[model samples]
Target: MHVFLIAALSADGFIAKTVDQISTRWTSKEDAAFFAQKTKEAGVVVMGRTTFETIGRPLPDRKTFVYTTRELLGFPPELVEATQLPPAELLAKLEAEGYTQVAICGGSQVYTKWMQSGLIDKIYLTIEPVFFGTGIRLFTEEITNTIRLKERHLLSDQTTVLEYEVLR
Candidate 1:
């Protein structure tokens, strides 16, 4: 299976102001449409517990999976499938279940964890036109691996979509 990180961020590389706050001001309608289209292409979407909580719930159209050590019995079962395993084991189980593509939707901690684990094959990042100097970063300081840009698509409103391959 192919694992990829899919997120939108400020040009300065921050995903949000905090784990619980999402800055939707910088996000354009075009970006939203594009993201929805791309998200639909994936068979499965996975994220951390924090991200799941931040977003409030799983997206309706796709099969959503959340990684959390805590019990998720209280969450709506129809919208999400919760698991407690680490990234590698989670991916292995998904692959064993015959899932072809998995998208990692995030908050910083989850992004850092998956990136550091070398479980992500590609990343799709939408760079908004603004920057937040005090927000949470996309990756942790421990990630030292280099990523090669495979492609870039410039949108009409100065926003950009970057596709990168995680180099080993």
Candidate 2:
């Protein structure tokens, strides 16, 4: 299955001002609109529990899989809140459910894990024209891999969205 990771970060590569402040407030409206459109077209959206909590709800018309090691109680019926499954296992399940692709949609930890596991096929990153001096980065751990730039688009708000294919 094709798993693409998507995120909007500051020019300095920070996803948010802080871990707890993981919202789209800093990103431009164009970036958010692009994000929503891509996620909607995806077969399913997968994110870490913290990321899911930040979102606060499942996206419409898409199955959202929240990966957590903790015991989640009273989750909304629309979301699939469960413990972390291996990337391959998760992809297999998604494929069996007729999903052609999955979108890894937030938080540094989740992005790092998937990238480290070599599951991300491509990345759609929108770089906003701002700098946070210091904050939560796009990846918590080090990832040393090459990516071929597929294309780039400068949004109406001047945010640049870069699409790259992971070179594996």
Candidate 3:
């Protein structure tokens, strides 16, 4: 299975203004269209509990998986499949279930955890044009591994989309 980290970040590398809030300013209509297209192509999508909560609901037409250690209750029926498994076990189970591509959508800690585990294969980073002086970063720890840029697309509003493959 291939794991990809997909997220939009400020120029300074912050994914959100805070842990609980989604960065609306950085997310444009073009970004949403691009994400919807990516989401349509993905077979499975995985995210942390906080990310799920922040979004308020699961995405339609995709098999969404939420990674949380705590019990997830009170969600709408068939909204999305929620699970509380560690990264390795979850990935193993998904692979066993025949999921080929998995996208790791995130907050910050989840991205850090999966990146540190060396499970991520590719990353799609949307670099917004503005900078947030204080906000939640994409990763908590510094990564020393080299990530090679595979592709890049310039958006209409000057936002750049970068694709990088994580070198093992």
Per-residue C-alpha lDDT of model 2 across residues 1-168, encoded as one tens digit per residue: 788999988899888887767567788889878888888888489888888777776777778888888876776755665758888888888899888988998788889888988889999999998899998888888898789999998887578999999997
Listed in order, each prediction's TM-score against the native is 0.89, 0.93, 0.90
For model 2, the stretches where C-alpha displacement exceeds 4 angstroms are none
Per-residue error at 28 for model 3, in Å? 1.0
- Note each model's CA RMSD in angstroms: 1.8, 1.4, 1.8
Q: Per model, how many backbone clashes are there?
A: 0, 0, 0
lDDT of 2 at 56: 75
* Candidate with maximal TM-score: 2
Candidate 1: residue 164 Cα off by (Å): 0.7
> CA lDDT, every prediction?
0.80, 0.85, 0.82
Off-target runs (Cα >4 Å) in candidate 1 are 23-25, 74-78
CA displacement after TM-score superposition, residue 48 of candidate 2 (Å): 1.0
- Point out the higher-scoring one by lDDT: 2 or 3: 2
